[model samples]
Target: MQGPAVFIDLTLEDQAQELRKYFKSLGAEISQEKSTKGIEDDLHKIIGVCDVCFKDGDPNEIDAILNSIVSIMVSIPLDRGENIILAFCEKLTKAPDIPLARVCLQSLWRLFNNLEPSSPLRYHVYYHLVQVAKQSGQVGDVFYGVDQLKSQFAQCPPSSEQMQKLYRVLHDVLKDTNSELSSKVMIELLGTYTDANASVAREDAMKCIVTALADPNTFLLDPLLSLKPVRFLEGELIHDLLSVFVSEKLPAYMKFYKEHKEFVNSQIGLNHEQNMKKMRLLTFMQLAESNPEMTFEQLQAELQISENEVEPFIIEVLKTKLVRARLDQANRKVHISSTMHRTFGIPQWQQLRDLLGEWKTNLNTVQDGMVKVAQAQVELTRKQKAAY
Candidate 1:
């Protein structure tokens, strides 16, 4: 709870007095008449004063001052309110003190929340908020700020350049903190670009695909296929290459690489050998899922590796935890227990449905057995009571 209005008023009064002296030393004035002139003028003067005061003044006092100013600004006309918000945010981006900058950003956020969602100023405020939050290097702040910017773009629709900038910043931050989220955001940004500019969308899509494939940790290629820009490249060589990664085995990948060696080398800009290794792992996972047992010769044929390389490759696949299997080297076979599917498509869904149906049948059988046992016990109890 806050203190009484009198105390609040006193605090602002003290800060105002200190600000006036500070302004006077710099050959400026914060006269009482200026406060009474109009909200825009008052806001302008307050923003200028706060810009300087925030540098040297106590943080708590500056926060209180900013809160009071924002409260007054919220009640003004929309155009004036927007202009004041923009001005404040412009100064905020260059704020040298992180603590005071946080306080100021909080004040701006409070003001932004109070504004109607349709207000034009919301986008500008969100944009500046993202910029300031990025400078702060706080993950939570950057994440929330970028999300708000993205949401605002849906409503206001930023230009192609703005969309690109947001994507770059989001990618840079999320790459370190959450790689999966980075991939998701990259797809979303590509979708946005697809809608904004068709000519450049293909280029952006290529970049997204290259980045996804180049990252050693990213193995899921199915999500990229969902974007329209990517799908639009259906007949293109790149799309075919992506399809190879998504579901095709190592042999198919080798064939594609051999056929489009120049395109893969020049356009994709990835290590072909490393890609082949990843494809082999994914293909092994597929093999483990489809077959209960796979012979060493079958693995060698599918993965295109020699007998000497089979065990080491299997060990690598095992390390991924995508497959659980015991290698019977003496028998030259792999007895698969379970495996994680590389892609959860129609086949996987059908498999899940079948599994669920089997479980349901088993449950029904157990329930019937229990019902029979209960009936037998009930009959025995009835006979015993009759004898009694």
Candidate 2:
């Protein structure tokens, strides 16, 4: 099951000849042990004496050869063919043509599908797939690869070290593009270590909280608060900091920072200005929920910002789509139409119930009106018929 040694300077014909020779020898070895003579014959026919590999052979000839190799790999026992197939697929991933590399990667996925769900080899193949996909710079491919790895990790829990490596890879891929999904994966990763290593779990949980706080698009902090790792930090400074972000406003965050300047600077490692920007956004969300129309002065007082900073701050919050509002510069007022809640709990549930009840009552009133109108029409029709 030795893979062919393809030299860089070899011509396409030479490369095809080397590959065909290697597959023939390997197929002979496999045919002696198993009844794969038909598959080996098909491999030779598909490759066929490298006659397709002329000085100006079609580039697709290489693709056809690779696909044929994949077919043979699928036909053979995984224990016999896995390493050889993986080596060939791994080498093809570095091919200059991206589409060719993608085809090979897809071939690997097909091989992966043939593996048992609990096979340790699945992790290795999936890791290689993710790296190749990352190198290709295709976000969709990266997502698909990561999602596959995540599924495997769930089915068979990995070591804490392995989980940490996965967390880093997932964080790097998704931190900027998708904060919500990143947070969710981070939480699940942390959950794996809660019983095994509490300290590591707490550290990773704090990291997740800091990441979520730093992300402007990540508005919901209540979910992070429930993580087991977060509970480990219950009496710690970072935990209190998390609480501030969840339910408190700008003044509370500023006061916390002022009280624990050293901890905030050294341990948290977040830019103070950026933190204030986020806090202002959250404070605006609270204000928007409570008040439909807030004057510039009211906003400045609550957000602890200057009058000049009010509009820009509001504009930044507007960009998050967390609140829907119109600015009245002349009237110095922000007229809020709607706002997203930071957390949904019993109070939010009650509000929803009340809203539903109101809608139901309104629907009942409309139904009664419709019934009375129908009765009146029927009575008028009957009176007209009797008079006639």
Candidate 3:
């Protein structure tokens, strides 16, 4: 079994016979029930052989062996699937070779659904699934597959302790990698588990991912970065989140810097004027959106800026496309047709309520005018009828 080059050169018939012989050495029988002890020993032997086969065997030989194992599990009766699953888990747990473990993982996925809800092997399967994925440089695929299995095996919810373990393993996997794949996987997990009953482990996994994202050592402005599931975290939690990017001085924060400027200078310990510009620009836009016509004096008073600064700030906002307004220097006012609000809170909500109320009042007035016009028409028609 040391060098499988000879096996690769063999004819199809010879290779099939050799595969059967290898399984026979592991005491594999034709779909029969055996003692647990007997099965464990056989599994150990099979794993040892497969480990060598993957190392020394050619691609064709390894593929053939994997295909044969899958075929045996599939052809076996439903009752026998558990044995194969446990055997594969055993191999996965003991095998130090990731290549061999990945190969064995294929069979585990194939036979996973066959396992019952009460099967003890489910834990073992997920445990190794995470490990193999983390070490194999295919963390995304591994976690995704495990997530599917978790849904399938819905009957057996892990204990709180077990959930913690699951979360920790996933955290380690995400913490070690900073690729788009890792970020996507982390985002998916956060979206999946962000409820009140979300396990402590799930929360830990999210923290681990967000920490990695804001880490200077592994920061990337990936497309998935903006989709971080932070709705479940608010208030001080959001503030604490800002500290991660602030301390790292990540450029990724430049886009939404206005929203988190509360800590830009005070807590973040960064002496950058960009935050001031952002805050002022954002407040200016909010005021313009809330008002259709505003005098220069009002803008200055609202933004706490000088008259000279008002026009320049408005011009900058116009350049940024944050608001659509015409500055009437002669009239000393701005005519705003449309605008965008960057952040929403109590002030914005209150503005929206007031605007809605005003809209309702205007609509009522229009309707009353229409009624009055209809009454006038009716009276004129009656007079014309009398004249006829």
Candidate 3: tens digits of C-alpha lDDT, residues 187-258:
545545445544443354445445544443332222222333453333443434443332322233454455
lDDT score, residue 193, model 3?
Answer: 48
What order do candidates take by TM-score, descending?
2, 1, 3
Sort the candidates on lDDT, descending order. Answer: 1, 2, 3
TM-score of every candidate: 0.70, 0.71, 0.44
Off by over 4 Å in 2: 1-72, 79-110, 113-123, 144-168, 176-180, 191-200, 261-266
Score residue 327 of candidate 3 by CA lDDT.
92
lDDT by residue for model 2 (1-388), tens: 1123222454333443455564455442222222245444433443333222322334566545554455455545556544554465456556455554555466456656655676656665665665556555554554544465567656565666766776666766676667666776676677666554666676678778878877767778888777777888898888899899999999899999999988877778777888888888888888788899999999888988898998998888888889999999999999999999988879989999999999999999999999999999999999999999
lDDT score at residue 317, model 3, on the 0-100 scale: 76
- Candidate 1 lDDT by residue in tens digits, 137-227: 5546545444655675465666667667767667766665665666666776786755445445787688678767766667778878888
RMSD to true structure for each model, in Å: 5.6, 8.0, 10.9
Candidate with better lDDT, 1 vs 3: 1
Q: Which candidate is the best by lDDT?
A: 1
Clash pairs, model 1 backbone? none
Query: Where is model 1 more than 4 Å wrong at Cα?
Result: 1-37, 45-80, 95-123, 144-169, 189-200, 215-217, 254-277, 294-321, 326-334
> What ranges in model 3 sit over 4 Å off?
1-20, 23-41, 67-87, 90-105, 113-123, 134-136, 144-152, 176-388
